[model samples]
Target: MTKRIVILGGGTGGTLAANRLRRALDAEYEITVVDRDDDHVYQPGLLFVPFGLAQADDLVRSRHRQLHDGIAYLGSGVDRVDTEADRVHLADGGVLDYDVLIIATGARLVPEETDGLTGPGWMTKAFSFYDLEGATALARTLEEFDGGRLVVNVVDMPIKCPVAPLEFCFLADWYFQERGIRDQVRLTYVTPLDGAFTKPVASRTLSGMLQDKGIELVTEFNTGEVDGEAGKLISFDGREVEFDLAVVVPAHGGAECIERSWGLGDALGFVPTDEHTLQSKARDNIFVIGDAAAIPTSKAGSVTHFEGEVLTRNVARFLAGEELDASFDGHTNCFIESGFGKALLIDFNYDTEPLPGHYPSAVGLPLLAESRLNHLGKLMFAWLYWHSLLPGRDLPGVSTAMPRAGKRFETR
Candidate 1:
């Protein structure tokens, strides 16, 4: 009998996992990928939509087309996962039985979770850039406004990219300056964190940059309500921040299927995953990757790519009745777009925070510092993401382990 493998969600984690496993395993194993739709979005490009740096149409492509031949693709929403019997229930009333299950379904934005967020001035004065639709709508709103208070608010933590809101602020400054209205538009950034970032050093450096750019930072603010009609954001602690234009990043939770699938997810709807193994804490045959897993790391594409390598090895080992590789460190790296044709790079893992110096080695790209070369690297990633990453090809010099050779760690 052929051993069946079922993977959920055809996003970055799922696509790469399915393709990687197909290459490693022989014809004996059957791999199937399921998703809600055929559209595979390049999530990073959503940020560029508002500024017309990129088009939303160009960022999306067919999901099944990205998969390797011989793998199956089912285009339908997941109803639930019946893990007790090792079966998956699809929304179209189809059932798939599997020997091993991989959950790569990423987080979903919950704009409705916030009071008055989707009401009143939604898409007119208040908007979001996290999605393609929202980003496209925000583009129009930004183009018309010449003078007013522009507020970039993160409704909660664990957003897609923690640095995106800051990038919006930085870009907005540049946008307004180029339009010759920098002095007229008041810019501010609001977040629940006490600092600009989770990492201390980066946060301080970013906070200084925000000050230099004349953008106000409001920290420790838990938003309770968005009174768009009143053009204000009301915090749970009763603090109100007024705004003429609100670009908000709402709270994110796991897929809706998780809520329907009993005993499959945590209270927050994310799968409880081992930080080092990428295996589900719930079951031996079930594994998780990317934003779907409630791990202590940034939920970015880079994390998913790194996890794919280790996850494929462990899954093969599990099927062979051999020891699994528990060597997946929480390796994460991101390019922070600082606007004005410049960007900053940061690298860190479970044991280390992002530090100053060069990445990979002393000769590589500068870490935690803005440069034009870093911006070019960010622009070049779109090409790499489509051709190399989706096809499960290795990126030369970029490894799963976070290199510590060139980092400047402070004396403790």
Candidate 2:
């Protein structure tokens, strides 16, 4: 008899994990990946779409082609998971039994969760550029507007690529500058957080950049409603921020299947997992990775790549009835595009905040500051994400553990 392994997503973490496990495990293990669609999107590219730096079509590829030849791919929406029966129910009325399960279904955007967000003024005066459709629509809107108060608002926390909202503001500044209409456009960045980023040192560094760029930083503004008709963002405290064009990043939650499966996810539809082990708290045989896991880390693509490496080993260990690897240290790192052909990179983990340093090894890329090299690295990541990371090929010195080499740390 052969053991079956079923993965619930074909996104970054699931694709890498399946490919990694295919190399780690033998032919006796039947591996299958299930997803709702064949379109595998490079989500980071969506940020560049609004600025016309990247086309939405070019950033997407067939999910089936990304997977290894040996592994099976199933395209179907998930209905729910039965932990007790160890079965997965699909929206198409199919069912799959598994010896072990990997849930990597990433976060979903809930624009309608905010009052009046999807109402009359949506996609006209107000827009969201996080999705390909939204980004493409925003491009057309951006071209028509000559100048006014352009606001970028993040409705809630725990959004995928937390820095993307900031990036949009930075790029918009540059976009207007190139059109020679920047002086007429008043740019503002509004967030629920007290600073520009989650980490203190990085936040301070980024806040200064916002100041230097002449973009207003509006912190702690909890957007409760988007009065699109009135062209105002009303906060929970009843304060309002007026805008001529509104770009909002709405609240995000885990996949619907997580919520549908009882005891499988938290209130927000995110799976509860051991942060280090990536083992699902819902059951012994189920594991989690990426934005679906309720972990205190940035929901960025680099995080998924790092998590895939650690998760692949643990799943193998679990199937062999061996001790699971607990080496995942909540490590996550990403490059922040600061516009004008410059970007900044940051590396950190659960215990350490992002600090100024070179990563992977000494004399590697600089961290926590802007540079042209980092910008090149940012643009170059798309090739890496597809050809290397998704295939589970190790990138020379990059590891799941955050490196302390060449870091500038303070002594107490």
RMSD of each: 0.8, 1.0
Regions of candidate 2 where Cα sits further than 4 Å from its true position = none
CA lDDT of 20 in candidate 2? 94
TM-score of each: 0.99, 0.99
With a 3 Å backbone cut-off (N, CA, C), the pairs that clash in candidate 1 are none
1-81: candidate 1 lDDT, tens digit per residue: 799999999999999999999999999999999999999999999999998788999999999999999899999889999
The runs of at least 3 residues in candidate 1 whose Cα sits more than 4 Å from the true structure, single-residue gaps closed, are none
Q: Write the per-residue lDDT of candidate 2 for residues 148-213, one digit (tens) a residue.
A: 999999999889999999899899999999999999999999999999988899999999999999
Residue 357 error, candidate 2, Å:
2.2
